[model samples]
Target chain A: MQLKILYFGMIAEITKCSHEILAVETKCNSNQLETVLKKKYQQLQSISFKLVINQNIATKTIFLHPDHEVALLPPFAGG
Target chain B: MHKKKTVFIEGAITPDFIANSIAKHQTKKSIGAHNIFLGQVRADEIEGKTVQAIEYSAYEYMAELQFHTIRENAFEKFDLTCMHIYHSMGVVKTGEVCLFVFVSAPHRKIVFEAIEYIVEMIKKEVPIFGKEVFEDETHQWKMNTV
Candidate 1:
C-alpha cells in the first residue's frame, strides 16, 4: 500500500520535502509508519510533532486506510 | 452552517486592511462593543542573533478545518454578534502585524471573553507554524507556550 505523507512547519524543513508517497505493508498503522520514518529521517527523532490522520490527531495505533490523508504537524504558533 | 471566511493572507497583514474591516462594520448598530487583537512580530535576540522576521506555514487543509471548528464553537459558547480572524502566511517582518482578530458583541464583557477564547483556541488547536528568522538569516521554529 502507498500512503501520502504530508509534512508541515519545521518537520518539513528537517525532512527537506513537503509531501511524498511511501510504499508500506498493508498492515502497518500510523505508529509503525512513524517509527519507520524516524529511522529513515534521523532529524525527525529529535523533533516533536503530531501525526494527523484524515485531518484529526492520531492518538492510538490505528490501521492506515488508503483514503486517509496523513500529515506530520509541528507545534502551533498561531495567534 | 456559517460560511467560512478567508483566514490566511499572504505576507504581513496591512493596517489598512484592519481599518477597512472596522469601517465595514458601521451599519452593525446592534454591536455595542468591539474588541480587536493584533499579534505583532517581536525582534527578540536569541543567542546573540536578533530575530528579523517570521515565515509561517501550515497544514493548510487541516488549519482551515480547525479555524471553522473554533469559529463554530465560539459562536455557540459566547454572545458574540460576529467575529473575524485573519492570520498571515509567508514572511512577516519584525513589528508587522501577523494576526488580526476582531470580535463584536452587544456588551463589552462578551467581546473580551470571546476574543480571549478564540485567540487561545487558535494558538493551541490550529496547526499553523512559524519559523523565526534572525538578522543573519538563521532561523528557528517558534512554539506557543500556551
Candidate 2:
C-alpha cells in the first residue's frame, strides 16, 4: 500500500520535505511504519514525535490503510 | 452544526485587534466577566544567541480540528457566553503577542477557569510549531515543557 506521510516542525526539518508517499506492506501497523521511517531517515530515531492517523494521535499500534492521513508531529509549542 | 472558528492570523496579534474584539462584545449584555490570556514571544538567550522572533507553522487542518474540539469541550465544561482564540502564523517578533485567548462568561469565576483550561489544552494538543529565530538568523524548534 502507498501511504501519504506528513512531516511537521522539527520532524520536517530532518525529513527535508513537508510530505511524501511511501510504499509499505499492506498490513503494516503504526509501529512498523515508524520503524520503516526510522530506517529511511536515521535522524528520526533521535527525536520524539507522535504518529497521527487521520487527525487523531495513534496511541496504540493501529493498522494503516492507503487512505489514512498519516502525520509525524513533534512536540507542540502552541499557546 | 457549529461553525469552525478562524484561529490562525498571518502575523503578530495587534493590540488594536484585541481592543476591537472586546468592543464588539459590548452588546453581549449578559456577559459579566471576560478573561484573556495573551502569549508574547520572549527574547530568550539560548546558548548566547538571543531570540529575535518566532516563525510559527502548523499542520493547519489538524490544528483547526483540535481547536474546535477544545472550544466544544470548554463550552461543555463551563458556562461560557463566548470565546475566541487567535494564534500567530509566519513570524512574530519578540515582545509581540503571538497568542490571544478571550473567554467571557456570565460570572467571573467561570471565565477564569475556562480561559485557563482553553489555553492549557491549546498548548498541549494543537500541532502548532514555533521556530525561534536568533539574532544571527539561526533557528531552533521550541517545545513546550510541562
Off by over 4 Å in 1: none
Q: Which CAPRI level is candidate 2?
A: high
lDDT by residue (A31-67, candidate 2, tens digit) is 9999999999999898899999999999899999999
Question: Where in model 2 is the C-alpha error above 4 Å?
Answer: none
**Candidate 1 lDDT tens digits, B33-113:** 999999999998999999999999888888999999999999999988899999999999999999999999889988988
Chain A TM-score per candidate?
Answer: 0.95, 0.97
What TM-score does each of the candidates earn?
0.98, 0.98
* lDDT by candidate, in order shown: 0.92, 0.94
Worst 10 residues of 2 chain B by lDDT: B1-10
Question: What is every candidate's C-alpha DockQ against the true complex, given to 2 decimals?
Answer: 0.92, 0.90
User: In model 1, which residue pairs have backbone atoms overlapping below 3 Å?
Assistant: none
Write down the worst ten-residue block by lDDT for model 1 chain B.
Answer: B1-10
Q: Can you list the residue pairs that collide in candidate 2?
A: none
Best candidate (score: DockQ):
1
